[model samples]
Target: MEFVPEEGKHLHEDCSTLILPALSIGNVGQLVADLLISSMGSERVGYLDDPNVLPCVGNDAYGPFPQGDLALPLEAYDSPSNALTIIQQRSPVVKGMMIEFAKNMADFLAGSGKKHIVVLSSLDFGKWQKVDMSSGLQIYYLSSSNSNGTDENCEQLGWKKLQEYDPSQMHWKYLSDLAEGNVTVEDITSVEDELEEENYYASLPFAALFSFLKAKGLKVTCLLCYCSEGDNISDAFQLGDAVCKLLQLSHPTTGIEGGKWRVPLSWMSVYGPPPDVSIF
Candidate 1:
């Protein structure tokens, strides 16, 4: 993978923390990324060129109007004031290449001097066996950091460490071993065929990315939400606020009146135009 910098913008060295979304259920992670990028006024520094990502292009996502800036499959942004770097992925990796994509990302991030990585994703709400009515929406976290401090911090913020993240589970162990190079492709291919999609954690991009990032010796924290398909805009905003809390950043807001969260203009047509008013 190669990073092609924007004409005058380069990746910032001081922006050591990276926040990216894994394409997953509900596309909540992507929506949260949109909020963060727009609210923080992050500048697009470059884009990633990789064959693993299916190609896509669209008008600028965050602008109040179509600004003529093109968006790509994977683009990098930097917010110097916040000392943060963000990656917005507009396309999914090709099927059967998730691990390869993760490896490429791990290598690039490690080489780029990134100290911490925050991965955001959504899980199938149906997989959650229990629902707590008192809690509006439960957020789960899995950290690669050995430090107990990370857990303590998240706990203090009312987040639960993902209890399902047992690396000893057969599928989970397989991914761990794969990331550490203890398993061969032949071994993986054979076992993968026998694995069932019912093992929810193993199937999502977060699992592959987390395992690979951990093997790269980087501190990674994954924040996940559970939701069914529908309008997930509220879920995205909640998770976005959770992320800001985790990082100790203030809730960012655009200059919109009576609104704390900034919704990108591109969202207006996400579900297509509103029904014709005259039809009412």
Candidate 2:
């Protein structure tokens, strides 16, 4: 009830898009947003949780909302860099706060026409164990990071673009771009500590988000691409890689395939009809 649709607008008609893994988890979604010409649904106005806890201390923040509880939002992205971040916002985790925020988002979504809530996230080998705290289920990851949704990278990679960017806008990016398996990682050590563990990892933001979206009667799905977490548990390479594919971009070839892209003529044919067709 706190959500106000635009005048002349129906609550069920507005499409709110979410870019995932904003802090520690949203690297992939950020890339897709930039290339696809999409943006964060609405840069948050207030945050349910406190900042200065961990990773989000430097990257994400939440302030007072003159509007309402629904307005207390978690706004990510401070730099001129535009990757649609779904950052975890912290290291020690704050799933409860994020869940509260998601609850508010879901309530808003409940009365709206959000066709689909596409969540972007990747599995951190460590959190993977916690989110599932499992009895032995192996998770496999495939990173389509280099496959471009379209040929947008040709424009994104130009030196001219990077030069004009504001440094503050892209703080998480430099690290995310760094290949996966670069961060120290560990697996879930206890099931009883699931809540405590996840709070510490806070990597389950995507799943919680999906659940919140569903609670609001929204259709939701999570998309992922594996990161090269070979040794590093927090590496977002796969997420980053998958994002590139979603947006159809290429990394400047450092003779690397994970981050670099090479879209083929055949790939372009996947979308349009037989090269020549104007349907009435």
- Top of the candidates by lDDT: 1
Indicate the residue-level lDDT of 136 in model 2.
27
| Per-residue lDDT of model 2, residues 1-280, tens digit only | 2533333432222224334443333343434433222222223322324332233333112221122222122333211133232322224335435444555555654554445455654444443332332322222221112221112332343211112112122221211221122321122123324534434322245544554554455555455433333322223334444444444434433223453332222223324556445653
Where does candidate 2 stray beyond 4 Å?
1-26, 34-95, 126-192, 196-203, 228-280
**Candidate 2: residue 34 lDDT (0-100):** 31
TM-score of each: 0.94, 0.37
Worst 10 residues of 2 by lDDT: 158-167
| All models, RMSD in angstroms | 2.1, 19.3
Model 2 TM-score (2 dp): 0.37
Q: Compared with the true structure, what per-residue lDDT tens digits does model 1 show for residues 1-280?
A: 8999999889999998999899988999999999888888889999999889999999989887888988999999998878899999999999998888998998899899999999999999888877774879898898886533147677878888877777778788887888889986578686675664647787689989998888889999999999999889999988988888888876444322354876788898889877899998
